[model samples]
Structures are given as C-alpha cells and as structure tokens.
Target: MSSPGDLPDAEVVPKKRWRIPWIWVVPAVAVLIGIWLAVQTVLEKGPTVTISFKTGEGLEAGKTKIKFKDVEIGIVKSVVLSKDYTRVVATAELTRDTANMLVDDTRFWVVRPRVAGGSVSGIGTLLSGAYIGMDIGRGKDARRDYTGLETPPVFASDVPGRQFVLRAADLGSVDVGTPIYFRRLQVGQVTAFELDKDGSGVTLHVFINSPYDRYVNADSRFWQASGLDVTLSTDGLKVNTQSLVSMLIGGLAFETPAASLSWAQAPANTTFTLFQTRSEALRVHEHIVETYVFNFTGSVRGLAVGAPVEFRGIPIGEVAAINTRFDPVTRQISIPVEVKLYPERFTSRFESGPKKGRLTNDPKALANFLVANGLRAQLRTGSLLTGQLYVALEFFPDAKKASIDWSRTPPEMPTTPSGLASLQDSINRIMTRIDKLPIEQLTASAQQTLDNTSALMQNLNTQVVPQATNTLAAARAALEAAHSTLLPGSGLQQDTTEAIRELTRTAASFRSLADYLQEHPEALLRGKPEDKK
Candidate 1:
C-alpha cells in the first residue's frame, strides 16, 4: 500500500455505506411494534363512566363486566370508596359504540342472586360472578355519572305496556309487585305505591302488559282481591276467591261492567278508584242522596250503620249513622238513626208513570202524602240467623197518623215499633192487667176450697165408708140364703120332686076324663068326634 498518497487516490471510491448491526434490527422492530400497539390502544379506547353503588360486593377491577341484555359492552377499570364513604364508586371503560347509550335515565344494577316479589332472580350470577347490568333509557340528555339501583326493575323499559294510577282508602294487603288479575287471570302487576300527601288515602301505580292493556276501559272497576269474600245474606252463604295466590299474597282485579263493555279504552296513566269489594265496585252510583233521620222508640240492638233501608222489599237507601239521645226532662232515651236515601232508586222504577216528575219536583209534598197515608218506618229482621236488622217502610193503615219535621237539618220521618216490639208491648199490657187483679185473694179462695174438699174426703173415709161396708155384708148374707134355697140336693128340692110326680099322675087321669067328655060333647058340638082312640 503506497501509503497516504495512494489512499487519497482511493478516496474517490465511495466510502463504505453505513450498515446497522443485526442486534439493533431486533430493537428497531420491537420499538416499531410498541408504537403501533400504543396507537391501536388509543384508537380502540372509549369514554369512561363512574357508577356509585351501596357496596363493592361482587365487583373486581379489570374483571367485572358491564353488560346490556347479557352482552358485554364495557369493563370496570377500578373501584374506590366514595368521598363520604356512604358508597363505593366504580370507574368503567365502555366501547365507543355504547357512548350514546349513556343517558339521564340509564339504569345500572349489579346482577346477583335475589329473591323478591314472590320470585327468584339473577340465578346465573351464582356461577358467573356478578356483573353490572344496564338498561338503556329513553331520555334525551346524555350522562356519564350514574347511580346504580339496588334491585332490578320488574319490567324492562322495552316491554310493551301501559301504566295506570289507582286511588284507595287504604293500602290493604297490596304491595309492590302484587299481581293484577283480569277475570282471575294474572295480567299485570303493581309497580309502586305512595301514601297520599293528606294521609287520607294511598296511590298505587300499576302496569299492564301488552295485549292485556287493551282490556282496561274507562268504565273498568277495580277491587282488592286479597282475601276470601264471604257474604251471609238472604241468598245464603257466599264464598268467593280470586285465586290461591291472591288469597295468600294479595292481588287486584279489574273488570268492565257488562253494561259498560262498549266504553273506550283507558289511556296510559289514567286514574281510577279502587273499591273494597266487587259488589261495591259494581253498585250503581247514586249522586242525588237525601238525608233523613228517624227517632225509634224500641231497642235498635241489631240495627247497625250501613244497614239496608228498604221500601217494601226493595233497597232504596242505607243507614248512615245510629245515635242515642236521652231526653233529660222526660227521662227517656231514644235512638236517632240517620239514613241516606237515593230517591232516584224509587223514581227510576216509575219513570214512565204519572208520578215520576211529581215526586222529583216536590219531594216534601210526596212525603206529606205518604205520611198521611200511614207510611211508617219500622225495624225488620233481615237475617234471623245473623240477627241483623234493617229499616223497612210500609203502609200501616191502623197506625196513628204522624207528620215529618221538615224544619230539621235532615228531615225527620215517623217510625213505628217493630213487630217484636209490638209483641213485647202486648205482653207487657197483659202482664199489667194480671198484676192489677187480686192475686192474693184468689189464691186464698182456692186454698179454702181445697181445704173444704180435704175435710169432706176425710168424713167420707170414716163414717160413710163404715156404713157402706155393713150394708154390703148384709146383701152378701141374703145372696147366700137364696143360693142355699136353690140347691137341688136340699129338702126343698126333694119335696118339689115329689109334687111334680103327683102332678104328672093327676094330669094323666084328667087327660083320660077330658077325652071321654070331649067324645060325648062332640055330639053336641061336632068337634071332638075325629079322635077315635
């Protein structure tokens, strides 16, 4: 090598190209893969959400999944206690596709084993561990932070149905999740209940599923079917039950009356009244009620509030109240019964009659006429077995005339004693008449007669009986003497036998003589000549 000079000449040749070491090639490839992975991780990432729960039970960071309709859509990244420590907060990462599903009304709850509302649910979580369940909301606003539910909803939002509201005097046995029945078939459930703000009643929210919702109409009557409805009336014992479940856990039943079946379907969230019984639900609504009071003189022990008030045998009203009033001056106690009468009930029957408008137009005149004609209210036994009494209006021709007191707040009607009371009064009168008689004197007279009879019997037993006995002995002696005289073996019998034989001989001689005389006399008489001996 001619040294530097030669090297300079060789410098014109291209310097050896820079070549990377094989070890570095491996590092380069690794760096490129790491960059690509970072970019992919960034691209696939989605929005983060925070969910607050009562507890951290069944949740695991990086392992717990967030699912909707059983499809995994997100995962829990971390879990920590809330600031106040009242709950646990979970941070979750959801795919980008689920970003729109986060809504104001979105629901989240843990899927775990739970028993409620007469049902067992979330059984699959026992094997798969618990997961966060999500229900998409119909809300318009979007949200990320959420409050999880302690329990799953009874119905999914997607379920096709309608809701309604019911007002009741009391909650009775009804509770959330109680079944609602249509003709004994379960068609819906109670979703919620709240006490009225005024504390006078309860408000219930119910949901009817799909096709069953169509059956609910504006005229539908709802009643509590929680227990057995047993009625003891003139028709006899009636026991009604909707179902075994209803009897045990309680339920609701609704039906449109046969006459109102053509009514329009009730819209969603329609309000309705919940009645206590089917009868009450189906009873004709009477808007025009007239209040009347009756002062009864007899005991009203069997008469109670709500007792039927009848015109003849038909019910036209009911007893609203029963009150006892004591007249201090007279020292007498009377029962004042308040009754609610539906005049329409009677008017409807005579709608086509001439008296229809007359009665409605001038009720006071009709009342006066009825009273003048002896219309009286009386307490009558409705059920002898139950000892239940009801009010009855009847025409009593013999009753004393009475008039209604129109000046009273509730007009006062005249009343008569019940049949039982009348009988009691008659018995009392008879007892009074008997009491007025001289009972002591009558008893004394009867005792005196008895004493005389006893004395007479004693005298007969002593004197008369002895004399009679002596006379009977004498008679018996006479009979013995006669019997002895009639004996055939005695001396008299022998003498009699001898006389009879002598008489026989004499008789034969006379016969011979008579025959001779008869032959001699036959010549003169021509009668005994035929006897030629």
Candidate 2:
C-alpha cells in the first residue's frame, strides 16, 4: 500500500481475471464418448448358429440374409467345408429377437426360385436373390445347430387342419399339392405321399382345413376327379371333370352319403380307401346275406363282379364273383356265378311278421320262399351298347320243376337257361319237326296222279269223236224224210186226205156190219136176235 511514487499511490497492476478454457474441456468429453461406444459395440453383438447343408449353393458369407416370416433376422457369417470335406457348414448371426426360435426342433431351408409338383414358388427370390427361411418347429427348447432341409415341407407347423391317410391301388394323375374338392369346391390339399411298405400300393397323406374338415364323415366316399370319364351308357356319353385345371393338374373329390349321420366326424389320421370311380365306390359292399350259385352255359364275357342282380324289375343285389370250376351238381365247366341278394333292398318298410325278416338272413326260409313263388334266375342283357350281362329273377307258373337245397354250404337256387340259349333251343325244335316230314314221297304221288289225268283226256278225244259223227249223219237223213212229208202241197199231203176218205167209208160199212153182226150174233146165240134184226 505504500505507493506515492512509491508512496501510497494505488499500485494499479491490471486486474488478473479468472477465465475458463471451454475448448480444452469439450475435447476431453469427446474422448470419453469414443471409449464408451467401443465397449457397447462389443457387448451388443448377438450369438451365432451353425447349419449343415448338402451344398453351399445360393449362399455367401456376410451377404446372404436369413429371414423369418419374410422379415430379415440374420446374416450368413461364414460358410466352410466340413472336416470330412464332403459337406458345407454355414454359420449365421441372428438378431436378439430370434433367441426363442433357436430350438432343437427348429427347421431351416433355403428359399429359391423353382417349380415343383405343379406349383411355382419363391418368385420373390428371383428379384432379391436367395435367402434362408426358418420355422420355429414343434418344440419349446433352444438350439444352436441344425441340419437344413433340401426341400420345403408340405405344410407349416402353424397351419390349422386335420391330417388323414388314404390308400390307393395306383397314384394315377395324383401329385403333391393336388387340390381336394367337395361338391366341385376346393376344400383341402394333398400333403405327402409315398409307396406303401409292402409295395402293394401308395399311401397319401392329406389335410383338410377347418370348417371344411367337418364335412368329412366315416361314410364319405372319395374318388379321383381328373381327366375325362366318358361313359357310353344307355342314355349317352357321360363326361366328367372337363375343366382344364383338373385335366392338367388333376384333382380328388368326396361325397358324404345321405346317411352320413350313421357315424360321427372322422377322427384325425383316419384311414380310408381311395376309389377310382364313383360307380366303383357304390359297388364296394355286396352285403349279400343269401348266396346262390347260377350255372351259366352261355357267354360270360361281359358279366363282372358288379353286375346288377334284379328281381321283378327291381334291383336287389349284385354279382359277387364269376368263377369256372367243376360244379358239385353239374360236374362240368359250368360258370358258377355267386350272386348276393340283399333282402333289405327289396323289403318295403310296410311289411311285418315273418315276411319282415329279410330272406337273405335265413337261407332255409329263403329257399322255401323261392320255391313257393317259383322264382328262378336267368341271364339277361342289361346294356345293348355295353353288352353287359346281368342276372334276372322271375316267377314262371309252369316252369320245369326244380328245388333248392339250403343245407348246402352256399345254398343253390333253381336256374333257367339264358334268354339267348332258350331262343336257340326253340329254333332247334322247329328245325327237327320240319326235317321229319316225308317231302319226297308226297312229290312222287302228285306226279303219278297228273300223268293218269293226261292219259284219260287223250283216250276221250280219239274214241268218242267218230261214234258221235255217225249218229249225227243218221239223224240228218231222217230229218230230210220228215220235211218232205210235212210239205203243204206234196204228194204225202194228198195221199193222207184220200186215205182219210177211204177210212171213213170203211168205218161206215164196219158200223153197219157191227150192228148187223151184233143182232145176228144175238139171234144166233138166242134166236131172239133175229126179231131185232
């Protein structure tokens, strides 16, 4: 404080100010932020998984992304050869959200552009390149490794439907992803199909979506609906499924009979038989309680197992089989046809008592019933165009008497000859009767009678002509004499008048002589005649 020149004069040394350097502090904070970012980057990096594939086609490390539900979820970090150098192992880094999808049962497959089984898929991949698709399959566990599938599965785990199995003789025009129809409406699809274990046929696994699945019942029938089924029936050609889609890709359809209520909804994984046609399904069960064997001596070419068995113009059953063997009775190459009769089909609901019990159920009663009614089986033509033969049952009052023995194993029925055979028999009988006639003998007798008549006519012409001529000449001479006598001025007329006058005179003298002779005879006889004279 002493400063006055040193004296107490205020020493004004410019005030030293306390100012902060903001530039240096800002730099320190920036350096700390840089350190923090590096640590977080290391901590947030997700875990990786390894997948094995047959080939590394359409894959590139760090370039190809793995997706789920069409959303990008991971990237292929690396692709390398297996230790055996025979396969590829692809390592992928997934997002944190995919943690739950990492399960033991998870599935993975690459999505690529391709066509298979009549369907085109993975079209989006054409523009964006190929990708890995993942599905969290049927489990709740976690996994870090998997073996990817070469092809996509028929259905996703999340699809809602019921699966069933069907057995068919041959998979004609059927393929995976084929549409299944119900009343001409698409309702389901075929999932997987494989040849049967025993090589007998093929087995198909199909799925029907909800709502539509309810339509399937135990009694439902399924048949192929592909191509054109042209049936030349009596009515006309019956064509089926002419649609281009069906003809190309093929399809299947089902029908729930009117008696669907006989059973409940079909259970999952239910097994069924796939028929080739609708008619085949109808002829499935003969349900024949009464079996009768008919021996057909005629042609059985068109007769088959499904041939109709009719009774009095009503359908009663079908032909169970047509077999050739030595019959027990005929002991010849008789075509013993097994026809099954379904009595319930013919018995009306109005019948009751012993008659109500179907004859098919009781062979003994049926035999008696048939005998009393004089029922016999005969073969008839069902379709003239198809040449299909069928069995016909009818009653003939005076039919050749026959009987049925129900005690036999299969119960035999009285059989009459086929319609064609009966006609042939009648024709042979007529020919036999005509052959027995004496045609040659009759011709010879007729010829002899004509010769005799000709000879008689010749004799009359030669003998009678001369005698008749002589008689006519004699009669002509007599006529000439009579004509001359009858002439008015002829000599015969004058002589007749003179003769009459002489006769009158002679008659007068005879009268007088007679009177005198009478008197003289009286006088001579009795003297008294003299006086009278």
Candidate 3:
C-alpha cells in the first residue's frame, strides 16, 4: 500500500473527481426508484373506509372489489371480525377519484342472486362471483364508517321516477318489487312497505317510471289486480285480470276516471287510498251515508256483509256488518244487520221529481213516513243459482204495524219476514197442527175398517159366491129345458101343427060368411079384401 501511495504521488494528478463506483450505481438507482414509487403511492392513495356486514360470506382479503355501476372504485384490503364479533369489518382502499364519493347516505350491499318483488335479479353475479354493490346517495355529508345492507335496493336513487304512498287495509299479496300496471301495461313497481304504527293498515311506497308517472293524477284510482277477479253477478260471470304475471305474482293497477282526466298530475310523494278491487276504486263516492240497523228473525245463511240493500230492484245501500245479540232476560237471539245507505243514490235520480224537496231536504222524515207507509226491509233471493240473499225495501200493505227505533245509536229500521220466511212459518204452523192431530187413533180406525172389509170379502167368497153359483146353474138348466120344448121335431111340435090346421079351417068358414054379408051391404072393406085373397 505504501508503494502504491508513492506511485500515486509520482503520478501526482489532481484528485480525480469523486465518483460512485459502478457497483454502487446500481444500488443508488434502485433507492431513487423506490423513493419515487413511495411518493407516487402516497399521492395516489385515497381515504380508507370500514364497512360492517352481517357476515364475511363471499368476502376475501385483497380479492373482493367494491364497484359502483359495474366499475371498480375500491377494494377490500382486509376482512376481520368486529370488536364484538357480531359482524365482519371490511377495511377497503378506495381510489383517489372516489375520495369524495363516501357519503352519509351511500348504500352498499353484497351482490348475490335473489328473487323478490316479482323479479329475478343478479343473475350476472352467478358467474362473476359476489361483489359489493354501491348506490351513491344524494347526500352532502361525508362519512367513513358504514353499515352494509343485507339486500340490494330495488331501484337506484338516480332512476327517474316519482314515488307515491298508498294506504291499504291489508298488504294482501303485495310486496316490494310487485309490479304496478296502468291500462294493463306494466309501468312501475313497489319499492317498500311498512305497517302503520297503529297497526290499522299498511303503507306502501311505489315508484312510477318517468313517462308513466305523468299519467297519475290527483283523482287516479288504485286497486289490486292480483289473482283472478271472478264476479258472479246478475249480469253473468265476469272474469278480469291485469295480466298472467299478475295472477302469479300479484300486482296493482291504477286508472284515471274519464271524468277526472282534466285533473292535475299528482306530485311526488302523493298519498292515495288503495282499494281491494277496481269496481270499489272506481265506484262513485257517496258523501252522505246513513247508517241503519235491522233486527231480522230469519235465516241469514246466504247473506254476506257486502250484500246489497235495494229498493225494488235498485241498489241503494250495502250491508256493513251482521251480528247476533242474545237478550239474556228473554233468552232470545236476534240477528242485527247493519247497513250503510247511500240516500244520495235515491235522491240523485229524483232530483227534479215532484218529491225532490222532501227527498233532499229531510231524508229522515221521508224515511219515517215511508216506514209508516209499510215500507219494510226484507231479505230476498238475489240469485237462485248462488242462493245469495239481499235486503229489499218494499211496500208491504198487509204487514203488521211497526215503527223505527230512533233512540238506538244506529237507528233501527223495522223489518218484515221475507216471503220465504213467511212460507216457512206457514209450513211450520201446518206441521205443528199435523203433529198435534190424533194420528194413532185415526190409524187404528183405518186398520179396523180394512179388517171389516177383509171379512166382508171372505164372507162373499165363502157363502154368497157359492149360492150365486148354484142359482146360475139352476137358471142354465131351466134355459136348456125351454130350448128343448121349443124344438120343432118333437111330439109337442106335431100336436101344435094339427091344432093350427083345424084353426085355419074354422077361420076360412067364418071368412066366407063375412064375404057374403059384405057383398050384401057393401060394408066391411076388410071382409072384401079377405074374399079376394
């Protein structure tokens, strides 16, 4: 090394510029590249978020992707059990481009095959495997922690449509994703439903797509179109349906009445009533309803709550309820039928009639007057085929005197026995009278008469028949003797022939004398005729 230092001094040149050895160059370049990569990574990294799910199913560390509209926006970096182990926590690394998309209302759910709301969805996920689906909410606030949904939304928030709320007595077969039809054409779907807090009804949220949403009006009528609507009315059997799908999966239908076509379009979030059938939804609304009850004492077998109450053949009301009450003191049960009468239905037809004032001004007074005039409610057979019974208000001039019980909560209208019931009563009375008759005594008398008749017949056969037969035989013998006596070849016949000849000779002599006398006197024309003979 000293010799090498002397040699360097001998060749003494200014210290060569300090330079990295070739072997070090490679390491330096690598370090520079590493720093550059780290800086780029730091610049491109986005906010990290944690998502809580019910389970870690179909989720894998660094493999599962979070997608928005089928485009990858983030990835699950790790999946671990939650602190309380009740759920799985997935930490995701999102791209810088999606840093602002993490919103409070943002929704995320695992995409899997599912059938709901009358539709099959996520069929594409079967081959591509399950992934986190996101729906960007229209919220302004940013959030990092999120709870994933168990089910995907029926529709994205950006879908152009109008939402409406429907109130129904029951949910029936309607559910989220149930189709909605307009004029038998599918136009919308149900988004969600909830039971009313009071538990009196159900409230459904429905969305109508853009063009179809415009068809909904303030006076639009909505009714269930699920299953087969088969009506057996006086007109005939009527079958109606929205579609085959509706019959299978259930659906709802809406229509705007012709009279309401000019009405304003319903706004988003409009509330409406859902009826059970199209007929009910489209029926004319009666503003004035009069409630009444009738105490019937007959079989209401075929009568139903919806049975019509008619005046003559015109429907004026419907049965609201049928109940039975027992009078403990009297030990009698009475069937109380509650009816809701649409008096306007009658008044509308008679608006310009002579009794318009009376009908419109004081319906109660008119009802009382009519009742006093023998207008009574009676059950009648509506359809013989179906044996359905309906209430009929008609004049019964011979009915017993009765009056309304106005003091009751729902005024009680007087009722008379139906024609069938009256007939039944008459039959029952006749049966009772027949039952009270002395049938046993009558039967004994009849048996005695039959026995006497049998004895008479036996006597005739034994004694009278034999005597008659003997008498008939004797008569036959007498007839044979007479016939023989009248035979011409017998001895008595010969004697009679001799006697006839003598008588003839005597008659000839008498005739000759008469002829001589007649010739003398020219009398006795008969004697002259004999002489000529």
Q: Assess every candidate by TM-score.
A: 0.79, 0.69, 0.72
TM-score of 2: 0.69
Of candidate 2, the 10-residue stretch with the lowest lDDT total is 348-357
lDDT of 2 by residue, 1-533 (tens): 66557655467688889876887888889889988888776666666899999999989998889998898999999999999998899999998778878888888988998666568889998889999998877787778989998877667768887888999999998888888888778888788889999999999988888788888888778888787766554233567773567778888877787755467889999998998886565443434366778766766877878677888777788899888877678576777789887766655434663434464567577666777677888888878878778889888777877788666668777788877888999999999998998979988998999999988878878988788888999999899899988989989899999999999999999998889777678654666634666
Query: Which model, 1 or 2, shows the larger TM-score?
Result: 1
Q: Write the per-residue lDDT of candidate 1 for residues 21-91, one digit (tens) a residue.
A: 88799889999999999999998888899999999999999999999999999999999999999999999
Residue pairs clashing in model 1 are none
Residue-level error in angstroms, candidate 1, position 198: 3.2
- Superposition error at 82 for model 2 (Å): 5.7
lDDT of 3 by residue, 436-501 (tens): 999999999999999999999999999999999999999999999988988989878889999999
Question: What's every prediction's RMSD, in angstroms?
Answer: 7.1, 15.5, 9.7
List candidate 3 segments past 4 Å from native: 1-40, 168-171, 195-202, 230-238, 273-276, 279-284, 327-331, 350-359, 429-533
For candidate 3, the lDDT comes to 0.89
Error of 1 at 301 (Å): 1.6
| TM-score quality measure for candidate 1 | 0.79
Looking at candidate 1, what is the lDDT of residue 148?
Answer: 97
